[model samples]
Target: MRLILLGPPGCGKGTQAKLLSRRLDLEHIGTGDLLRAAIRNTTPVGARARPFVDTGNLVPDDLVNELVAERFQRTDRPSRFVMDGYPRTLAQAHAFEQVLAQWKLPVESVILMNVSDAEITRRVTGRWSCPTPNCKATYHVENNPPRVAGVCDECGGRLIQRADDNVDTVRARLKVYHNDTSGLIPYYRQRGLLSEVEGSGSIEQIYASILGILQPQGG
Candidate 1:
């Protein structure tokens, strides 16, 4: 059940990926998570990626490809996985194809979660989180505010919005998404591997929609 999730930053790709991975017993390979882990651990790739990350710039295709390639080379490489936030560009798509070919674990579907730009902006900009190392609880301004205003319900810490979650940054990220997916979406569609899912609904509703797409007929 190798899958690829394609969507803008605030389209709930991460949430859906987590749900699908658990339900299908597949590895959840999120490039964002991997990059964060690398950066936190100060690995070679992390060091190289930090400058770009700090500036809210997209990491180069070669660096991202190298990082993903290393993941695929691990002894416990994931044979069944759901990828989120990866293969963002045509170059990445091509490189990923080669890697999957090497592993013989071709993607069965590419889910493109669609959300409007305005909605994306709203969703991202409303997000706030606890910065405490032990409890990084997240909340949305409208949808899931903490019990007390500007406070973490779990840790009683002041909530902080990520720097990249600002409106301007989100708009920039969306532009990048549009540019990359202009090529990526077509690449998958032409291969008969693309599935479109609306990302505006509740998490469960969206998850159900995806399950309907992936499940065998009459299963």
Candidate 2:
């Protein structure tokens, strides 16, 4: 099963993808993680993508598509994979279709994890992360606070909220998500591959909903 998980920031797309990948034995491919790995390795595509990523700008569609294509062309690529973040815009979606066609990989399901903006704000604003470079553990003030306030349980490092996780920054991200990524909802729906799942629930609840949608298709 080739699956796509779509959602706004703080919508738990990554968490759900990880769960689904483990349960279904599929590769969990996150575009952000892939870009970071490429940049760390200094690949040709990474060299082109580094500037944009470092400057907090969106990487060009062609460069992102190239990264996706490279992943698909790998000899060890998994037959089943769950894509957490890619095709964020309509143009990227179309470019991704071309890549899929070229690779002969068809998407079996696209899950849209739907959550309200208010809920997104609440979830994102509470997020805090460890300061240690290697121990990037995360905590939430409300949902999963550390034993000691502002301290990382694993590394004993101070926990600080990321600049992008601030309420104002989260709002800006929400606006961009609505402007750029929402179109893909309709794009996938028209193809009869989209499944809408309520996202404002427990992790297991949301994962159960996603599984219910995909199990019928032999996930």
Per-candidate local distance difference test = 0.90, 0.88
Q: Among all windows of ten consecutive residues in candidate 1, which has the lowest summed lDDT?
A: 210-219
Q: List the residue pairs that clash in candidate 2.
A: none
Q: After superposition, how far is residue 49 of candidate 1 from its true place, in Å?
A: 6.4
Q: What are the per-model C-alpha RMSD values against the true structure? A: 3.1, 2.7
The per-residue C-alpha lDDT of model 2 at residue 32 equals 88
* Candidate 2 C-alpha RMSD relative to the actual structure: 2.7
Query: Which residue segments of model 1 deviate by more than 4 Å?
Result: 33-59, 132-135, 154-156
* Cα lDDT for residue 115, candidate 1: 95
For residue 219, give model 2's deviation from the true position in Å: 7.6
lDDT of 1: 0.90
Q: List candidate 2 segments past 4 Å from native.
A: 40-42, 53-57, 130-137, 146-158, 217-219
Q: Model 1: per-residue lDDT, tens digit, 37-146?
A: 77898878888989999999988789898778877877888999999888889889999999989989898999999999999999999999999999999999999999
The clash tally of candidate 1 reads 0
Among these predicted structures, which one has the highest lDDT? Answer: 1
Residue pairs with colliding backbones in model 1 are: none
